[model samples]
Target: MKNYSILSVTCLIFASLLLVLGCKDDTSGQQNAAGQQLAMSLPVVEIPTKTLTAYVTYPASIEGVVNSEVRAKVAGYITDVLVDEGQKVNRGETLFKLETQSLNQDAAAAAANVNAAEVEVEKLKPLVDKNIISEVQLETAKAQLQQAKSSYNSIVANIDYANIKSPVDGYVGDVRLRKGTLVSPTNQTPLTMVSDISQVYAYFSMNEKDYLNFIQNAEGATISQKIEKMPKVNLLLPNDSLFEEQGTIETINSQVDPNTGSISFRAKFDNPSRLLTNGNSGKIQVPKTFEDAVVVPKESTFERQGTTYVYKLDRENMATAASIVITQEIDNLYVVASGLKKGDRIVAKGVSQLRGATEIQPQEIPFDSIAQPIQKVFR
Candidate 1:
């Protein structure tokens, strides 16, 4: 029995030592994990207060100040084409000459009738003065002469109409007629088009909702007053290049097109280089400037269930999920409307790898380093 008790005691002592060793191993493992959790490496940015401009781009149709379709007034075969496409022309410049041979023949016959009527009037005048014939006969001869003169004038006008002239000082558009092609006022196609592009007009449409908002935001007591106070706009050419010259909003349609549910707007842009041509399509960028707005990088924000959030680093370098109300989105940046202010630091990148309340190792970067240049944003 004593041997049995001694063996039992030895077994208890061995089990106790094993339990102590297991506890020490678990404590050491926890300590090692805590020590390894150094601050997470994250690029951060301080919220900045600056003037930010937000723009919305819409497709626009370019047109010259004047787009005149030069059509033939008199029907005849095109005998000569005087101008080429893209040629700069002035008002009254002849663009095409039509064959007036038939017109000339008609004019010649009308002239013969005019001459015969003149001779008849002269022959009757002397007799009427001498009382050799009734006064009614001389009056009838005079009326015949008047009718002949009218016929001659009509034929002359038609002959003059054979010369097609440009109605404006502008560049020539597509020339649809060549020599031997017949054109006239009733023809469905025009001989060519003249576009006065010295100042070009860009036509764009704004939906009713946007139009109302735009006018409301503009500073003025009336619609016209608001339009006058609106800022200038920029154009994005078809090649994705920006136009050097800026444009101003000139006019808006009086009523919205019921079928389209949008109002048309015309913006005038000076085209000294003649780069903007008729029928050229591009985009118009209208910028709305926000002064002293709190801005943040859009990459730092994440959307959850339609709400946008970001990891904002506090004084202790701990990340807190902040829900920000954005007033506008400008390229890769956001203008914060609320929930954040200037001087608040945010994780510029790597926000997806962070969890709330976790500490961060901040790598601060300049605001411009993360966002586009201010001039580019507006330009």
Candidate 2:
């Protein structure tokens, strides 16, 4: 009876051990299946062709098309500042008035001298006609009278010059001199400046390599023709906002600047509202268009060891890393130069979680939907 009881206990212990091992194996299989399901579902998109424009920006300086300096023509103290800074004025309008007290006194003396000389000439002419005095003496008196008159006229002209006037019809710049400040013609600094803001010029520069490339890509035999054929460019203000008016590239420097090794370019913009002024700083955005280019969203790309890549989806929805050469990056899209083409499917997001040849259940999405809020620069 004892031997039979020992045999029954041993069988029962073995049976319990087998049941626990079988339960563990089933749990492991279920976990593996869950992980595979999670990896299979990811968003993918088919590449599309687009007309993309990329901007190459350079630092630009703004200036009025006509910047005229206001200077005093005669030495004097300013009595009145007729125009305030930023005030709009017309041509020949008085900007400032210099004190004419000393000039008036000098003019009085010159006038007296002219009168005395005229009286003497008249007396001498009568004597010469009567032959009572030598002709040489009369001629000398007439010459002295003419010199006195010229001196009087010069003093009168100087008094008129004391009223400084605007040379151009434009807005006034800073008031470098105020009331009672002494100014002269030979002063190194100008009294003030008048800028014609009806039109403004934005000056920018490009290096030799870029200039050559720009010229070669333009469709013209001459520089002027190239400018005529080139598309209009946009201006970026210092605050990073686009200017309301578009600008046209009007002039290019004939020769490259040896010191800077860059060529200068001038673009003109209409400033009807006078928003742009002299000495304003901004950027010039020169656009280069890529027609019917294959582009991908930046989110779908990753960089590895300085090489850009995207996870391409094969026919079987398997993810494989493919290299791409980027020609230009605009806003949130990359213009693919090589290694990718239109209609190719790429993992839209979650590319980091994928591995080589990993099969996925691609949930296809529209390309534009993923590349939202793209800058519309093509016009």
Top candidate on TM-score is: 2
Candidate 1 lDDT trough over 10 residues, lowest sum: 370-379
TM-scores for candidates 1 onward, in order? 0.85, 0.88
Q: The CA-based lDDT of model 1 is what?
A: 0.90
Winner by lDDT: 2
TM-score of 2: 0.88
Worst 10 residues of 2 by lDDT: 370-379
Candidate lDDT values, in order: 0.90, 0.93
Residue-by-residue lDDT tens digits, candidate 2, 1-379: 9999999999999999999999999999999988766557889999999997889999999999999999999999999999899999999999999999999999999999999998999888878999999999988988998999999999999999999999999999999789999999999999889999999999999999999999999999988899999889899998889999989999999998989999999999999988899999999999999999999999999999999999998888789999999988888899999989999999999988987778888998999888875667985
Instruction: Look at candidate 2 and give me any clashing residue pairs.
Output: none
lDDT of 1 at 228: 90
Give me the runs in candidate 2 sitting further than 4 Å from their true place. 1-23, 31-39, 374-379
Summarize candidate 1's per-residue lDDT along 235-310 as a digit string, tens digits.
9988899999999998989899999999999999999999889889999999888999998887789988999998
Total backbone collisions, model 1: 0
